[model samples]
Target: MFRNVEIALASLYVTTTGVLIAGIYYVHQILGVEQWGIIAFLSLIMTLVVGGILAKIAITPLREHFHHLERFSKETLHELNLPINTITANVQMLRKSHTDEKSLKRLERIEIAAEMLKERYNELDYMIKKQSEREKIEHFDLREVIEERLVFLRSLYPSVTWDVMIASYVVNCDRIGLGKVIDNLIENGVKYSPKNPIITITLQDNTVSIKDQGIGMDEITLMHIYDRYYQSDSTMAGYGIGLNLVKRYCDRYGIALHISSRINEGTCVKLEFKKKGIVDG
Candidate 1:
């Protein structure tokens, strides 16, 4: 889309250049006033014709490239679902069958890996489907969703202890989308924190905060944190798309998202929910 805009602007520049040249020639060389009007009209027509042709030539290839990329991404995401589901199901079955401690622990690791893969897949799916499908927005209890996600995540990150202080906050938005945002924030806190780290989660005044005493990022990292596929530390096991997706969801729902951090201190992510209404009446 940006490339197309550049092409259009270039075409306009070409038209202006042509018009300027013709106008200069008419003023300096041509003496007949009647011919001047005729020449100016002819120049305008010629400029439009040339500009239109050049814009078409410049934009067609770029449009085709983006279309091809979109198709490839959709096809790849479609192919991934079958294998991810298979791995997840098999891991669950194995966990149920294995009673031994070491075996169960190994199985748990596999389950966590499978779950992470599934989440990345879902994010990709959301990016593609959200453009076409109308969002299933409705009022849902924020506290309920937060607790539900914590239940699923707690076992996965056994070392990190969560401190949650939530009041009855109701939000009108897509529940699943909001859950993803919450999941990503908590996951990041756990992933970067030290052994048995404390994660503070608070929800009040229509705002949710996730704070971690982990390896906090620098200013440069914070600046590019929301960019797609931009990871601050390449050593960390993340594709760097999670926070970007969170930003998109927040923008769509009028949620104000903010992050504050300093190296070796900590990081705090605050999400202020926009009001549609309150539920705890």
Candidate 2:
């Protein structure tokens, strides 16, 4: 589609230039050198007018395409919220009415899944609102967010050993975006680690560190870790955007991000939040 648009624009430009040149030639032939200056000025004005029109024509479809995509995203997110909300409400009702242990456990899993889905929905909603400069920034407990993400991730990776030492730290930022950053870091730790991986999470003094006993990256791989879609191990199953997302959120929120890794040892990621974004309880 983009290629076609480019070709069309290029063709229109060439055609317009040709017509301008031909018109100049015809005017120069019919009139004489005395009128050359006036004709040249007219041609320049005509070229500017034609170029503006052509530019508008070329941009119209692209503008419409982007608008269509934005509408689709908003509509899809709205539709998705309905079903997720339904599942959450039903699960809560079932939990209250059913007293059996097995049913309650199943309901708990469904609730967790629904919460995960809701988090994803919020992430998407954040991105959209962020583009429109409408994302909400509020004070939230950083430790609570981290613990919530750990709960969801632990459910998914039950075999992995988790060691968490977190202190109460409140931060003012886009909560969903920050939550996504935490989720990506922890998920990557779990994904890259060996079976029964030991993941350690520590939070203190407005800084958080996540260390994983996984097949770590070399110096070269570490350099490109934040490059979108650049994976250290292609054999590993991932799109390689996790670190990229982490880096982006940190940069946007004035958070300091650092990663250290060795080939055979493991990887450790640290994030230091900005002082202004932190609030003391």
Among the numbered candidates, top TM-score falls to 2
lDDT of 1 by residue, 155-174 (tens): 67888877889888878888
Model 2 lDDT tens row, 24-127: 87678766545878888877777778878888888888888888989999999999999999999999899889999999989988987888898789888888
Work out candidate 2's RMSD over C-alphas: 3.9
- Lowest-lDDT window of 10 residues in candidate 1? 272-281
Candidate 1 pairs with clashing backbones: none
Compare the candidates by lDDT and give the number of the best one.
2
Q: What is the alpha-carbon lDDT for the whole of candidate 1?
A: 0.83
TM-score of each: 0.71, 0.80
Query: Candidate 1, residue 169: CA error in Å?
Result: 2.6
Q: For candidate 1, report its TM-score.
A: 0.71
